[model samples]
Each structure stands twice: as C-alpha cells, then as structure tokens.
Target: MSREKLLEVKNLKQYFKSGRHSVVKAVDGLTFDIYKGETFGLVGESGCGKSTTGRTIIRLYDATDGEVWFNGENVHAKKSRKELKKFNRKMQMIFQDPYASLNPRMTVKDIIAEGIDIHGLAKNDKERTERVHELLETVGLNKEHANRYPHEFSGGQRQRIGIARALAVEPEFIIADEPISALDVSIQAQVVNLLKKLQNDRGLTYLFIAHDLSMVKYISDRIGVMYFGKMVELADSDELYKNPIHPYTKSLLSAIPLPDPDYERNRKRVPYDPSMHDTSEEPEFREIKSGHWVLCTTKEFEQYKAEMENK
Candidate 1:
C-alpha cells in the first residue's frame, strides 16, 4: 500500500428519524483514509454501522454531517449531471445480497452491459457485445451464460455477475459491502480469491466491509473496528490481531473460533463489559502506538501506554 490516499472520510455522520422524537445514528463520526492499492477492512458485529459507513462514503445516503473526499475532490458537494456521471463511473459498489441486487428479468449480458451503455465506453453494438463478453470471462463466467437470466444461476454465480457489472464501468475504487456473506461457506473463499486476483491484475483499491474477523485479516492491509456507530480501534491487520488494546477489540478477537480442536477446547471467551471504562469524560480516538489507535479517555490512554510498555 502506497502513502497516496485514494479515499478519505472525515467525521462522517448519518442519522435517521426513528419515530416521532427519536433519531437513530447509523454511522457517527467516522474518520479514516484508504491508501491507493490497499484493502481497508471495516469489521464489527451486526448493527455496528459497518455497511452504513460504506453506503454513506459512496453517496448512496446523504451524509448528515462531515465530508468525504475521493482522490482529493469532495464527493458530497453538488455537482452537474456530467460530473456526477463521471464520478459514478470511477466509484462502483458491489452490494451484499446476490439474490436481490440483480434484476431477475434482465439477461446476464444486458445486466453487465448497462454500465458500458451508460458510460458510452463502446462505440457500436459489436463493441458492446465484445466488452460484455470480456467482462463475463474476466469474472469467471463464459459468453454462453451471458444469455441466461439471474434465476438460472446460483448465489455465487450471481455474485460474480454483480462483480462483472461493477467492473464493466472500469472503476478505480470498489466498496464491497459484505460481498461474500450471502454465499455458502465453500463458495465464500472462492469469491474472496477472485477479488484478490482481480486486485492484483487491475490495481484496484477496496473498502471491504464484513463482520468475520478471520476472513478480514486475510485480505486487509489495515483495519478499523466499530461499535455502536463509532470507531473503537484502528491499526495494521497483523498488529491489531497480535496486540489488541481496546476492550471491545479484545472481546471480538477472543470470539473468533480457531480451526485447531485442542485450541478450541481450551479457548476462553472474553465478554465485553461497556461499563468497565470511566464515564466521567467521553472517550476520544487516541493513538496508543505509531499505527495503533484506540477510543479511550485520558486516564485510560496513560494506562494503555503503561500496559504496552509492560508487554
């Protein structure tokens, strides 16, 4: 991963009106940067605002506050129709559900070619067909399947079609919102491997969001952990796994089941207690190490520093 920042999210907030008087904060005060050519994994349990963060960054939802910068340009600012179209072509998203994301009525070829048509990437009908075929093959599908509908394919295959559709626009950055969670366990690894290969071949950058910590560590160069709509920790993948400073992070790490039978039998689960921290002052995101950050109050920050020194 280079130092060049491909995407930056600064104090982003998204709130929704729940009933008559309540407001639900789906994503609140998220700040991070994704370097060029790196996979930045955002992981947390369900309802942690992981998926909402991705959607807000991509402008699927209008941010309630703060800014999003993509390649040094503000993404949320009002732009002309042509500029928005250009922005759309550069940033594409692969949604979580393979079944609901695609149109059951459209054939595979037309589905993938929709972007190509909108962007006017191909000059003629022949060029469009050839481009669609190439994209289908790029995503592990053949031209023969192009004529088939979404109902004819399985979950994993439909996901590949979704991937093909995203690539049809030749996007620079992709927000993969739990792309593999809907597939079977056996098929999940296959999709991940394909994504890895595509990143290597196409020099793509990703914002990979999911709840599975082990799978995230496999593909992420750096990671950010969220809880209750706020980031609790951020660090390099290996460092975060080896030395988790936050209580919530430790609890999350402890919950990951290993493959070893003996280790699994002896493993201890750490239940996170939210009340363990001091509540006199609100916690802020502070750097505990050069690359490791944790949401902690001033007193906890010093204690964490001492804990690291003792380690």
Candidate 2:
C-alpha cells in the first residue's frame, strides 16, 4: 500500500437522540487513515456503527464531533455550493441494500447518468448516453440493459448499477457500505472480484465496510475491528487474522467457519466477555507493536506486549 494518506478520520463521532431520555452513540471517537490506491476494511457486527462512520465521513449525516479530512480538506466543515459539489465528486458511496438503494422508477441509463448530470461531466444527450453505456459495460452490464428499470434486474445487477452510478463521477474515494451483504453467497464473490478489478483499473481508494471477516481479509490491505462504536484494534489484514489481540476481535475471528469438516467440528467459538476488561481506568488506544493498535488499559497493555513477545 502507498504511504500517502488519502482520507483521515480523527476522533469522529456520531450520536443520535434515541428518545427524550436516551442518546445513541452510533460512532464514537474513531481514528484511521486510508492510503491512496488501497482498501481499508472496517469490520464489526451489526449496530457497531461501521455504516454510520461511512455516512458521516461522506457527509450524508453531519458528524456530532471530531473531524474528517479528505485529501487535506475538512469534510465536516461548511463549504460553498461550488466547493461542496467538487468535494462530492471526489467521494462517493455504495449502499448496502441493492433493492432499496436504487430508484425503481428510473431506468438504468438515467440512474447511472445522475452523477454525470449533476457534475456536468457530459456535454449533451449524446455524450451522456455514451458515458452511461460505457459505465454499464464497465460494470459488466451491456448497452442493451440501459433501458430497463432497476426492478427488472436481479440483486447483483442492481448493485452493479449502483457501482456504475458511483463511478460515473470518477470519484477518487468510495465508501462501500456492506455492498455484498445483501447479495446471495454465489453472487458475493462476483461483486467483490468486480470491485477489485475496478480498483485495479481506476487506481481507486476504498473504505470497505462489512461484517464478514473472511471476505474483509480477502479484499483489504488493512483492517480495523470495531465494537460498541469504538475501534478496538487495527492492523494489517494478515496480521490481524494471524494475531487478533482484543477480546472482541478474537471472538469475531473465532466465529468464521472453515470449509473442512474436521476443522468445523474442532472449532471452538470464543465468547467475548466485555467485563474481563480492566475497568479501574478507561481503556485507551495504544500501539502495542510497530503498526498494530489496540484499545487497552495499562495492565492489559503490558500483558499484550508479553503475549506478542512470547508469540
């Protein structure tokens, strides 16, 4: 991966008033950087705020606290319409649910061309039509499929259209929020391979958010483990899988089933007990190894250091 940081999120937080008496902290104090031309996977269980983090960074929802810096400019800061439009073109998002994200009323051509229209990437109807057709072909769909509405396409096809729409603006960074979770098992790999091919061709940067650790390991250069809206661990994808430090991360990794019958039979699910943490002091994110970070208290940090040394 490149050393240059394309996107930096520092202490980002998103909170919502659940009701008159309760507040839900969807994302709290998340800090990470995505390098140019690299995939940074954000993995966690549902309701851990991985989706909220993506939305907040893309400015779909205003952040309750902290800052998101994209290519050196603050994302949460207010900008003029012209500046905002430019920023929007630089960053785009692919939603989780293919059926819900696309417009049932609009044709595939119109849907893909929405970004082109808003950004004025094309000059006229002819150019727009050509661009849409090009994008459709780029995402594995043909020019003939352009006239059909989203409802006519299958789940995987709809997602390809969604990807085409995001790519229409030629964005430098894309937040793929659980893009494959809603697809069938067989179709998931196809979508992932397409995303990989697209990234290779376009030199794109991605924040691939998902709950599937196995898939995340396959696609991401680096991974961050989130629990209860806080980032508990961050490391190289292979490193994290080889040596998961946090209790929650270990618990998560243990849950992935192997294809082998023998391995599946022997696998023991590691139950995460949050109460095991040292509560005398609040846990802080600290670098235990060169590039690995984990949230832990002072005592736990020492123990983790010893654990690594012994490993």
Candidate 3:
C-alpha cells in the first residue's frame, strides 16, 4: 500500500561562511519527502550533514535556501509567534546526546511538563502532573522516577527520558537525530523497539538521522544516503542493501561488519573518491528505478541505469 507524504523538503540548502571566506556547505541542494507513519532514515559520515538536515527541517537551524513544507504548509517562512507555537507542538525533536540534551537541574516531571505548559494542554497543576506520569510510563519508565534528575539515570535511561520529553507534546512528526547513538550497545535495541512500538500505537512520522548505516536499515522503511553536503542515493532499505549504485553508498555498505568471522576478515572495503566522478556539470537527483533515486550527472545517470539493467 502507498503511504501519504506528511512532510516534503524541496531543494533545502544550509551553508555557513567560514573565517577564511570559504563556506561550509553543511547541507546542499537536498530534496526528499517523508511519508506519514513511516520512518525515513538519513545516513552518512559524521560531517555529511545528516544531523544538519534534521535540524533544518525542525527549524532549529534556519535554511540558507529552499522550502520545507509540512502538510503543504511552508515552515521556513516567517509566521506569528502563535502560529509557530502550533507548529512546534506538532513537530518535536529527540536530540543525539542524552547527557547534554536534558537539563540536570530540572526534575523529569517538570521537564516533561515543558511542552504541556507551552501548549496549555493541561488545565491545572494536577492534570499536568498526571500527563507527565503518563508519558514516563509510555516510554517504559516507572512513575516513581518522575521526581529524579538527569544525573541519576544511565545513558539508555536518559535517552528514554528524552523520548518521553519529545512525546510530551503529542507530536505528529518526530525528527530523531541519532536517538540511540549515545546509549549502550545492548540498550540500543531496546530504544529502537520502543520507537517501533510508539509508531505502531501512535502512527507517528519520523525522520531518523544516523551515521550508523546498519541501525538505520533496521528501523527505516526507506533510507537516504548523504555525502559531504548532498544526497547520493535513496531507496527502500532492503533494495539499498542489495544494490547500492553510488561509490559512497557502496563504501558505506562494505564497512558494515559481517556475522561470519571468516567473511569479515576477508571483506574488501571500497574507498570512495569523489574525484572519480565527472562533476564539471551540476549533478541532479534522478529516479534510476521505481522509487530509487540517485544523484549523478547526465552521463553517469545513464550509466547507472544501464548497469542496473545488466544485473
């Protein structure tokens, strides 16, 4: 079944001018749509702007150019504080660092009530406290922990608190910027499972950003691979794992560890050299197959199509 697009990002560009007069093109000319009730994973290296893209979509960082339309409404354009407040309640973010994201001085109950207070969802102090307890329970935490601070919990528990905070607003769309990266390896799956359960129950739409390609594939229905500042490939999770066309995509796939010890030792890592591709002409994202998008120049796009056909 086809899903409806809840959010659309068109030609989004984020660039920062450095001291030397050179610009750091954090996210350049990227365009993609996230469907409602589905997880769209954005993966790449640390400096590839995966986080920047997520930040820009949520209006944490203003875009240098382009448009982000949520439910056909332009989010980047200026709006009254009241209008922006409504948007904020609908779209929430789960930051990457559990330790840094939460306020140490604030109790969990007060932290969760931040959104409820902003939107005036609760009528009184009693209702707000009840809402906070409900959110803690929803994220798999006990109600007794509500009085505790961020310093009392482990990394995994801290992330769960972050999740609870994002859910406090009862958002329709969530931008999870590596929510599980800061947690322990054993606890990573727990958080992922919680996110999946929340999606099933709440029908939440997500733009999940991560540098860990394997984790992204497991949670995301569709995945987009970004390079230094541009999207290089996008396709269904299974299709991308089986057939990665771009040099950067292939390199990323090759780096994932194999289960078999023998195979892992012998696996050849592909090095991505952007200079190999002809870039005199500006590259554009083209559909190389049904729902499979790739960034390439005119000649390279044709070559990619032919290569897929031969296979």
Residue-pair clashes per candidate: 0, 0, 0
lDDT of 1 by residue, 67-159 (tens): 999999999995788878989999999999999999999999999999999999999999999998998899998999989999999999999
Candidate 1, position 104, lDDT: 91
Q: What is the lDDT of residue 174 in candidate 1?
A: 98
The lDDT ranking, best first, is 2, 1, 3
Worst 10 residues of 3 by lDDT: 1-10
| Candidate 1: segments with Cα more than 4 A from true spot | none
Candidate 3 residue pairs in clash (backbone atoms < 3 Å): none
Tens digits of lDDT, candidate 3, 1-311: 24788999999999999998799999999999998888999999999999999999999999999999998899998478987999999999999999999999999998889999989999999999899999999999999999999999999999999999999989999999999888888999999999999999998988999988999999999999999989999999999999999989999999999689999889999999989997779888999999999999999998999899899
TM-score per candidate, chains pooled: 0.99, 0.99, 0.98
For residues 1-311, could you state the per-residue lDDT of candidate 2 as single tens digits?
57999999999999999989999999999999999999999999999999999999999999999999989999888578988899999999999999999989899999999999999999999999999999999999999999999999999999999999999999999999999999999999999999999999999999999999999999999999999899999999999999999989999999999899999989999999988999989889999998899999999999999998998
Best candidate per lDDT, number? 2
lDDT-best of 1 and 2:
2
- What is the Å distance of residue 19 in model 3 from its true position? 0.5
Worst 10 residues of 1 by lDDT: 78-87
- Candidate 1: deviation at residue 258, Å? 1.1
Global lDDT of model 3: 0.93
